[model samples]
Each structure stands twice: as structure tokens, then as C-alpha cells.
Target: MAKVLMKGNEAIGEAAIRAGCLNYFAYPITPQSEVAEYLAKRMPEVNGVFLQGESEVAVGYMIFGAAACGERVMTTSSSPGISLMSEAISYISGARCPAVFVNIMRGGPGLGGILPSQGDYLQATKGGGHGDYKMLVMAPDGVQEAVEMTMLAFPLAEKYRNPVMILGDGLIGQMMEPVEFPNNLNKEPTNKDHWATNGMDTRKSKEKNIVKSLFLDPKVLNDHNLTLKSQYEKMKKQEIRFEAYNTDSDYQILIVSYGTMSRVCKTVIDNLKIQGIEVGMIRPKTLFPFPEKAVYDAACKKSCKKVVSIEMNMGQMLEDIERCVKGKKEVSWYGKCGGDVPTPEEIINHIKLLLK
Candidate 1:
């Protein structure tokens, strides 16, 4: 239970091990390669399995295989790597397999850059893969948070019988911070017996539990889709998390951000307040079931004049921000892409422009 200074990627691996995820398969990519490297060494010490697969595409199926056997499994990748794994992610979702994926995103639409960027926001929340399936996405702001969320992912995935993602930008994956892994993170992972494809010899019944995404019958597929939809609605109600900073008082501008960008916005809000500029911030901790109602309430404050979303991409999260505010207020976006980041002063200047 001692706190140690560690990079984000390494911490994620350690947390997963502590959370009883003994199988990890991933391909190394910038900003998150440390996760695999760390696991490669540590997994053996704990009697776990760690494999650097041929590629992200291969790793995705490796994860699916372990998960279908009812074992806790995970994989990590950067944006481009995640793109390759999307097809398998979709299949895993359709099969209702419990697997964890960590995306330490870099700049991308293609192989953009190795530096930090929030360019994968849309891909993480809006489904990078095809079909009507949705993964529970958790966005963390710092290395310590990254550790905690990584541990939480396994339980959530098992609870819903679905895939879960820990979404962080490159900054979070590469930065160093002090973190402590919780001792009570379900070290003895949940049982997945009822639906798991354990061998016939291990099950009570001789009938096999087939794990496949194929549904040829229209009626059966519709029922399956409806079940998925119902779970999503339950997640929205039970899992929405956001941090409200300086939102209790009147403010001139409301800033919405997540992950590393929200950390920078916090500094801007503090500095702006010193100069008699009042600003409040809403930092969403969950991106999928976004804190829409929280955002709408903050944006509708009597003294709130403008809304802005500052990101490290060409404003992917702005789409959700706009949806939350509706047409009552126009949502403005300020962004830098291709691994370019915004400074606190730059964000303060944007706030000034919004005020004018």
C-alpha cells in the first residue's frame, strides 16, 4: 500500500495486476509502450501471462480468447493501434465478453504523431468499432487517477458482461506521478461461470456455452439489441461522474474539458480569478454517459455568459458539449492538434475573447 512515483503507463500495468487481471496481451506503441514493458517483467513475478502480440489486431483477439474463458484480460494501445483493434473490439462487444482496453491516445486520424493529444475522444465514446454496441469509457485526469480507473475497469466490465475502456491522452500515459494501488480492488476477480465458455469438463452441464456475435434471426437480434440498450441506460444513471470546480458561485464563463486538458483548465481558472475574471469548470470523469445534465445546469447559470471547450484535438469533445447546452448558448472551441498542446495562458486569452 505504499505510494510510488511512476509513469502513467507503468502504473496502469501494476494496477491491472493488483486487480487480478493476470493475462495481458498488447503491441507496443508510443506513449503507452511502457504498459506492455512493465507487464512483461512484472507479470511473470506474479505468475501472470504477458505477451507482446504480433500487432494490435492480434492482441485484440488474444484478449477476446482469454475473456471468453472467463479470465480477466486486458490490452493497451495508442490511437493508431486502437484503430487496428476496432474490428476485434466490435466482435468482443457483440459476444458480450468482459475485456478491458486502455487507449493512451496520440495525435491521429492516421499515424499522426507520438506526442500527447486527445484526438481519440470521439472514437472512445462514440464507438470506434461498428454495430450498436457501446463500451463503458472512463477518462482519468492524472497518473493516480489512471491507476484507480484501471482497477475499476475490470469489475465494471464483468458486472455488465461488456467491454470497458480506460481513455487517457499521451500526456497522462507519459507523465510521472505518485500513485497507490488500492488493496480492495477485487483481487479475487468476480465469477463469470453462468455465461462463460469454460470447457465442457469444467461445467455442470454437457451443453456448450457458445460465444459468438452472429445472430441470423431478425427477432433474436432485435431482442439482443434491446437488451444492450437497456444496460446502456442503466449505466447512464449509475455511472455518470464529473467534477464541478468553482461552480457553486456566479461566473462569467463556463469551461468544459476532460482528461489532461481539464488539468490545464484548472490552472487557468485559478489564475483568471486572481485577475478578477470569474470562471467555473466542469471536468467530466466519464465521457460516454457524459454529464450532460450537469453541463446544462452550469451553462444555464444566471451569470454565466459563455461556454468553451478547450482540447488537444480539433475539438472532438465539442460535439457533446454542444449537445448538452442545446441551442440556448453557442459553444465555442479552441484547439491544437497533431500533438500540439495549449498553455494555461493561451486558454485564459480565449476566455477573455469569449467575455468580449
Candidate 2:
């Protein structure tokens, strides 16, 4: 396959189309608005549906409706936009409808800035909305990985009959890089006759398919929640993904990071290695089913004395890192949330300080 140079957001839109997802309903937001812009033009050429909803809230429901009808659907938004869509996301999860959401995170507590930040890590992994719900969250470090994750998200969502999220910082959306859409990822939408409300006549089933999230009876609701819990547990057993860097060596410090932050840590590790300071890193690909065992084992290495959680947020992933380390090694955090990414030099300085 010939690689093409493209913006991360544009690559994501093209990836989705290649995956056979024709229905895209979204509202434009910074750093990710290019996805909407690109798809708006390309969708028509492919005879796909590209509708810009009045708001993210409306877009969320549009996805839910399409998914309930067993159509491949997706939406993209930034931090505040995703917040408005959280309620519908919850409903989609409870109803067991397969859908995809892309969050190109911007700085925030509330509409902070248009710059890149990993502030939405907690919201994506932990529940953004009310209730015991989780999305299969994937974080991409670069444009090419972003394309692959967006294509993979569709099948994963359908496999589990739940929403899947592509969590990228604004940098991942704005940066241009060479990317190739894998031909293997081009696939037909899965069969949804078991639950989709497409139509009895369409599926040739006598029973009517009704999609819903409202469970009035207490025991029934409890059972539904338990079912969701089982799926999440299954994910933990089968879907945890991560990348280890320089762990083969006897490293003095282990760094746990993801997305764009991990890229910086990689550079830091290489520069430190040149100076006789061995620093290792673990980059998580899946956020919800976090690579807990990877972190735990790396931290337990005898050569590793300190562990640090580096992110673009105010240590949102720190709690999870500490949990995985389990007091075996000292765990700390270093980060910036004002849209300024920590430079490799800054990280090396921090590591040196920790060692001293």
C-alpha cells in the first residue's frame, strides 16, 4: 500500500470510510474539526452519510439511532463537545449498541484552550457520564497509529456491542504525517440480526427487535449491569495492549505514559541511554483495559528504583500507575496541563533529579 502524507484528523476520516462505516454524524470542534470537514466532502463521493448535527448532544443520539438500526456509525468531538455527548454515550452503552467516538482532547476543566492536552484521560477511561459504564478506549501516539485504531474500533465496538473511543490529544489531530490504510482492515459490517431493530421483514425474523436502555424492574436492571460488567472483565483478560521501551536493559527508572506524551518519553529514554542513565518506558495502547501487568512487572524490576507517570494532564493516569506498582516502587508524577507539552530535556532533568 502506498503511504500518503495527511493530517491525523483527515487520516482518521479516511480510515473510517475504508472500514465500511458510511454513517458519520458529528459537530465540528477544534483540532478535530478537520475530520468533519474532510468527511463532509469525501462521504458524498462514496455515497456515505455525513450529517453535521446541531450540537454534540444531537450527534451522540444520531449515532445511537444509527447503531440501533445496525448501521456502522461514528462521531468526532473535542473535550467540551464530548461532555455534552456523554449522556447519549451512556444510553448507547446500556442499550448494547455498537458505535464509535473519537475525542481529540483539548486543554480543559472548562473550555480551556484549542491546544493539545491529555485532560480527557479520566473521562474516557473512567466514566464521563453517570453509571457503571466503560468504553474500549485506544490512545494513539502518531498519525499512522490513529488511522489503524480508528479502523479497528468499529469491529471492537461490534464485537462487544458497545461504544469504542479513540482518545487522541489535539496534537494527534493536527500534526501531519505519512499514513497508510491497511487493506486487511477493510471489512463488511458484522451481522446485527440478533438485536438490531432494522426491521422484522428485513431480517426475516418473526420476533421484533427493540433497542433500549431503560430497565424498570430492579432485578432485570441488575442483570443488565452484570452483563456489562462481564464484558469489561473479558476485555481485561483479552484486550490489554502496551509497548515496552528499553526494558531489556537494567533501567534505573521506569516511565509510564501514553499517546503523544509517550513519544517524548521515548526520546528522553534514548538521550538518557547515551549518557549512561538507563530509563525505560511502557506506552499503553488501550486505556480502559490498562496494561496493569506490564506496569507492575516493569516497576518490580530490581534495576528499576523509581517509577514516574508522565502525561499532558495534571497526573490523571497517576492513580492507575500507583495501583499497578502497588508500593513495590516509589511512584511519582510530572506533567503540564496548560497546553504546553513537557520537552525531552525537561523530562531528562526530572529523571536525573529523581536518581540523585
Candidate 3:
């Protein structure tokens, strides 16, 4: 309704409520506890439900229940909590329940740290849970995108009848920014009623609707996978979103990164420009859809020599980088792990080393 200065984590929680999500379930985790705190107080005032479950395990099951009942439900947690929730997130996907999830990632192989990191990029994009499922992962670089994408996530999840993820770093979650709500949330695509468990009586009398991922027979499983693959093709065509910075230059190096790291890379590019070193970046906004073509295009360019994929993890995104580039151009990676963010100066140094 009105623009406000908000922290990314708290704003994401508030934006979800404003976007008509009344049910939330979560177990608090550091760097994102503000999300839980904001909603615990706000949900009751809006006549909504905010339950602090026993653990992330319980909270995830709570999400499964509410979403199954046709409620717009969501949950927020950091990496380890999300890891605990993955079992339920898998079940939620099997039921084909459209829901929203926010992973304000902290670095970790396990209990690594509480600071900002992009280590979970692959986990978010690829199948993190059991079975063949895809979550529409939206990587937000700043607090504004965090707020806006949190609101956008629900409709997008509803549109595809799939889970949607708001993948942000702890820094992005803690930073402050100005944000505005969409003019009308209902302006989104109309797909909520078809698969949702709204009513049974309104449908055809003889037909029954079942949402599940189980297909025991080999042929049946093959067919089901085909159907999912078709849906992924549509996403590749229609929903591949990315941002390019300084990409038009005759750059010798293209920096491949996303989320807050990509925002930092933007500044690195500016500094490189001052030093007469042309560099560019391809920031994948939808990590699943991946903007693979964009990655290929950049590396295929004659002016671009190599791509340096920067991430908080050692080399999580570099796998995708290898996939896209496929030897068209060289791809190298540099990073800091366990909740350490790479500074612009450090990134520039990495770029210089790559050049050398």
C-alpha cells in the first residue's frame, strides 16, 4: 500500500502477509529470526495463523498441512533448518501443493556459521530433496528485491502449481531498503483454482483428484517424468529471468555470480573499468531456469576470454557454469566459505589473478 524502509528479512515476512498469505510455520534460525518475529506479531492482527513449531521438522509438516487445506502457506529458515525441512518439502512437492519458502542462507556443510553466504545456490536450483522435483528459485540481490520477490513468489508458485523459493543471503536479509507493493496482487495469472483443494462438490461428480508423486510402475514413472520435463521446458521458454551488467563491453572476462555476490561484482566491474579492464556479469535471477543460454552466449562471445564464477561456497555455482560454457570458453571459480562474504577488493584480486 505504501513505500517503507524495511530490512530484507522482516520485509519479506510482511510482504507475504500483504500478498494474502495468512498461514506461516517456522522454527527460528539466526540471520532470519526477524522473519518469524515479524509474522508472529502481525499474523494474529490480520486474523491469520502463525505457529512456532517444535522444530524445523514440525514446522515443515505444518506447512504441508496448511498448504494441503488450500491455504497460502509459507515458512522461513536458514540452511540447516531448511535441510531439516527438506523431507517435508519433498512431501509437499509430491502433493503438488503450491507454497512459498524462504531460505535466508548462512554458510554451512553443517552448522558452519551465521553470516551471509551463497553456498546453497546449487541446493536451491537442483533437486535438494528426494525425488525429481523443481522449486522456482528466485535469487534477490538487495532488500528491495527481497521484499518484492517475496510478494511475487506466491503468485508464481500458484501459477505453476509448484513451490517457489526466495533465496537470499543473510546480508540481503539484514540490509535495509525502500520497497513498494505491487499495485494489485490479483493482477497475477489465474491458475490457483484448477489444482487447489478449494472444493470437491463443484467438480464433476464421478471424477476424483489426487495430487502425488508416486508412480510405482516403470512406465508410469517414465510418463510422469516426461510431464514434468515438459513443464520445465515451458519454464525455460517463458520464465528464465536474469540481469546482465556491463555485458555489452568487449570484455575479456565475464564474472558469473548471483544474489548479493553479483551485486558486489557490479562494483568490481566498475573498478575494473577504471583500470581499463573490461569485465561483465551474468546474474541468474531464476536459479532453476538458470539462464543457460545467456551463460553460453557470454562465453561464446569473441570479446570474452574466460568467465570467473564467484560464490560464497568453494564452487557450487561453478558446476552450472561448466554445464553452460561446456568448453566454449574457460570457466574458473574463486570463493570464500562458511559465512564469509567476498569483498569487492578480493573479487578484483581474483579477477586479476585469473588474468595473470
Candidate 4:
């Protein structure tokens, strides 16, 4: 397929459509509002439903309602907007509804700046909402990857009967890059009628499908949670995705990063290679499954003495890196939050200091 230059947020909106998602409900916020802007006009052309909710909180439940009916549904928002949607996200997870959420992260604890940040790593990978639930999280480094991940999120969500999150930074939302909509990604959703509350008559089944998150019975709720747990375990085993760069060489240090931050690290690694300072990096594509084994193996390399977690946040992913390394190698964090994305030169300097 021929690639067309497009803004990241717009590409994400189109990608969802290409993936056969027909329902989009979201509230506008910085860095990701363009997704809603693009989808609003496009959804009508495709005979899809596009409605902007009063708030992110309302949008979250809107997604839950569509998803419960087994309709392909998605929403996009920034960090603070996602926070508002957390309760509904938790409810969707508990109900075992399939849905997709794209988070174009902006800086924040509360209404921070509107610049790119990786501060929401924990919220997406760990549980953003309450209870024992995991959203399959994918972090894309560039616009093309963002398009691909967004397209893939739908099937993955339906496969696991859980929410899937496409975690990108502001750069990913604002930047323009050449992207192609894969023809194969647009496939009909399957087996939804069996479980979805679409309608008994429509499905030609007498069984009434109940879509809900509230389980009052203690044993039933526990069993429901266990089922969710098993799905997460299956994802860990089968869906971990990552890119290992410059790993063949015997490197002195390993850098673990994701999203836009990892792109800077990649550039730094290449530049360092010219100076004969070999640095390897593992760029995680799936944040939730987290590429744990890949990180552990890379850190344990006899030639690698240190592992550094490079991110746009104040070391949010640092804890995960530390756990993966398991004390075999020292793990440290280098980051700048609130929209101050570290440059490649800055990353290089940090590595040089580490080597010294």
C-alpha cells in the first residue's frame, strides 16, 4: 500500500476506522483532541457513530455501553482526560467488554502543561482504574507504528475481551509522518453475538446476554477476577512485543525506554557506536506484557554492566526495569517530565557519564 503523509492523531482516527471500529465517543483535550476532530467528520462518511461526550468521564461510559453491545468502540484522550475516564475503564474491564483507548499523553499530575510526556506509563500498564484488571498496552515510537498499533488494538481487545490502550506521547499525536492503512486490518468482528448484549432476536438465540461489572456474590466476583487474571497471563505469554537495537554487539550499557523517548535513545546508540562506545537498547512495543524476558536477558549480558530507564516522566518505568533486572545489573533512571523531552545529545551525555 502507498503511504500518505498525515498527522499522528488524524492517522490514529483513520486507523480505528480501517480496523472496523464504528463507534467513537470522546471528550477533547490537548495533544489528542485532533483525533476527535478528524473522526467527527469521517465517522459520518463511514456510517459510523461519532459523538463527543460532555466530559471524559461520560465518554468512558459511552465506550462501555457500545462495547457491551459488542460494537467496535474507541476513544482518544490526553493524560488528565484519561484520569477522568479511569472509573469507566475499570468498569469496562470488570464487565469483560472489548474496547480500545488511545492515550496521547501530555504532562501532568493535575492540569500540567500540554506537551508530550510518558508520565502515564504506570496508569496504563498497571491498573489505571480500581480492582484487578489489566489493559493490554502498546506504545508506539513513531506515527507509522502508532497507526499500526491502533489498527491492531481492536482485534486484540476482542480476543482477550478486555480493553486495549495505545499509549503515545504528545509528539506522536502532533507529528506528521508517512503512514499506510493496511487493507488486511479491516476485518469483521467475530463471535461477539455469543456474549454481547446486541439482542436475543438479532442473534437468533434465546439466551439473554448480560453485560455488567458488578458482581455482588463474593464467590462469583472472585471467580470473575480470576478469569480476568488468566486472560492477563495469556497476554503476558503470547502478546509481548519489543524491538532490540544494537544487541548483537557486546555493549557496555543497556537502555530501556519506550514511546518517543526511545527514539532519542536509538539515535544516541547509533551515534555512540561511531565513537566505539557500544550501547544496546530495548524498546518495548507492548507496555503491559512489558517484554520482561527480553529486558532481563539484555541486562544480564556479561558485557553489559548497567541498565538505565530513559523516559519522559520522573522515572515511572524505572520500577519495572528494576524488577526485570532482578539485581543482576544495576538499574538507574534518567528522565525529565512536564514536557521537557530529553534530546539525543542529552541522552548521549548521560551514557558517557555512566561509562566514565
Which RMSD values do the candidates have, in order?
A: 1.3, 1.0, 1.9, 1.0
Q: What is the alpha-carbon lDDT of model 2 when measured against the actual structure?
A: 0.94
Q: Rank by lDDT, highest first.
A: 2, 4, 1, 3
Indicate the TM-score of model 1: 0.97
lDDT of 2 by residue, 193-236 (tens): 75589877788677887899999999999999999999999999
Count of backbone clashes for each model?
A: 0, 0, 0, 0
Task: Look at candidate 3 and give me any clashing residue pairs.
Answer: none
Model 2 poorest ten-residue lDDT run:
186-195
Q: Compared to the true structure, candidate 4 yields what TM-score?
A: 0.98
lDDT of 3 by residue, 237-283 (tens): 88898998998999999988888899889999999999999998999
lDDT against the true structure, each candidate: 0.90, 0.94, 0.85, 0.92
Expressed as tens digits, the lDDT of each residue in 1-356 for candidate 1 is 88899999999999999999999999999989999899999999999999989988999999999999989999999999999999999999989888999999998778888999998888989899999989999999999999889999998888888899999999899999999877866665475765589888888766788999999999999999898888889899998989999998688899999899999999999999899998999999989789999999999998998899988888888899999999667788998986767989889888998888
Q: Which stretches of candidate 2 lie over 4 Å from their true place?
A: 204-206
- Per residue, candidate 4 scores C-alpha lDDT tens digits across 88-194 of 99999998888999999999999999999999999998888999999999999999999899988998998999999999999999999998888866467656875
